[model samples]
Target: MPAPTEMPTKHSTPYPTWEQFQQMEKRQDALEKRQDTTDRRLDSGAGEFAEIKKAQDTLRQQQAAHGQTVAEVREILAELRELVESFGNLKGTIRVMRIAGDVIRWGCTLGAAALGLWVAFRSLGGGL
Candidate 1:
């Protein structure tokens, strides 16, 4: 007969000793602790994922609002461009009117001077 500590021969299967069973129980306890830690991390990760999803939705809404704001800004810019063009045309018309008024004023001044000279000449007996 072989002692319990001796290696098994080819014909017989070996059974675990008391020490080996205790080591296996300790390893099982460590594995269960590691599994519990992993499960806690996974639960926290699920919460983080929900937070990230909420933030993404908020960003999407902000992006849509920004798009609308950009469109409104473009529209305002277009209207401002049209107003600038209209102001340019109005400036030209004002310039033309000012030139016409200057010409008329000068014509009236020259006519008044000529009439004064004619009156002085006729009174001095240099009639035409």
Candidate 2:
């Protein structure tokens, strides 16, 4: 009987040669270098992002403090408005008091003059 022939495989080469293996190693090294560069860039970007977040937090705190200060200022303004209104009312009251004082002084002066006239006439015997 004849010896059995070997069956043909799908690919032409069964395994990679020395030069092909060397080329694959070089490609893998390049890929690793690129990955390292990407990792370093991502790390630096993360630090920048953290710094930006911290700054935003500080700004928010400052804004809150300013809001409280504004509220306090508004309260002070309201109190000042009430004080001014009270002063205006006091001015009107003082005017009314001054007018009343003038009227009382005039009434007293007229009464005293009339009494003096009556006494003089009685002493002079002017009545029949």
Candidate 3:
């Protein structure tokens, strides 16, 4: 078998010489430091994300409570509507009863007047 002229790599090699290899190492070290910094930032961001999630949950609970309050208000309004209708009906009944009482009072007064007139005519010797 013939000796291969170059080494094979899994990835394309941009650094084929000694100086290029040294430069590649420097770039790799820089990239590793940047990646560490990024990881630290992400760790701190996770705490913020947790707080955001908690706030969202609280907001959802408050919304549900407000919905219950609205439902209760609607129920109260319906009850009030019924009460108002009952009150109006009672007013009409009172008016009818008052008119009937007036009629009865006037009828009694007129009857008493007619009886007194008849008694006076009888005492004056009028026909029975």
Candidate 4:
């Protein structure tokens, strides 16, 4: 019996022409350009967000200052109210003192006049 002969193997090769290589390069360049544009937009958005955060911080600080100012004003108003109340009490005391002084003065004057009349009656020999 004769031995079987082996079949010959075929080798494969890829051949890319110059025009095809140029087209691929152009496509890659376009893709890179689009990616760069997208990256720039992302960076701009991030910067804008940072600015907004700074503005929010400034607003919070201003609000805190305003709150402190309001508290101070309230304290001042309370003190003023207390002062006014004290002044009113003082005025009432002064009015009461004035009324008492007037009463004492009138009582003393009437007593002196009555004593003088009694002395005159005695000197004229009037009966007790």
Which number leads on TM-score? 1
For model 1, how does the per-residue alpha-carbon lDDT over 1-128 read when each residue is reduced to its tens digit?
A: 46788977754546666778899999999999999999999999999999999999999999999999999999999999999999999999999999999999999999999999999999999979
Instruction: Give the runs in model 2 whose Cα sits over 4 Å from its true position.
Output: 1-11, 108-128
lDDT score, candidate 3: 0.91
CA lDDT, every model vs. true structure: 0.93, 0.90, 0.91, 0.88
Please estimate how well model 4 matches the true structure, expressed as its whole-model Cα lDDT.
0.88
Q: What's the lDDT of the predicted structure labeled candidate 2?
A: 0.90
Model 3 lDDT tens row, 1-128: 22378665635464457777899899999999999999999998998999999999999999999999999999999999999999999999999999999999999899999899999999999988
Model 1 segments beyond 4 Å from truth? Answer: 1-17, 107-128
Candidate 1 residue pairs that clash: none
Cα lDDT of model 2 by residue, 70-124, tens digit: 9999999999999999999999999999999999989889989988888898899
* Between candidates 1 and 4, the TM-score winner: 1
What are the models' TM-scores? Answer: 0.70, 0.69, 0.68, 0.57
TM-score of 1: 0.70
Write down the worst ten-residue block by lDDT for model 4: 6-15
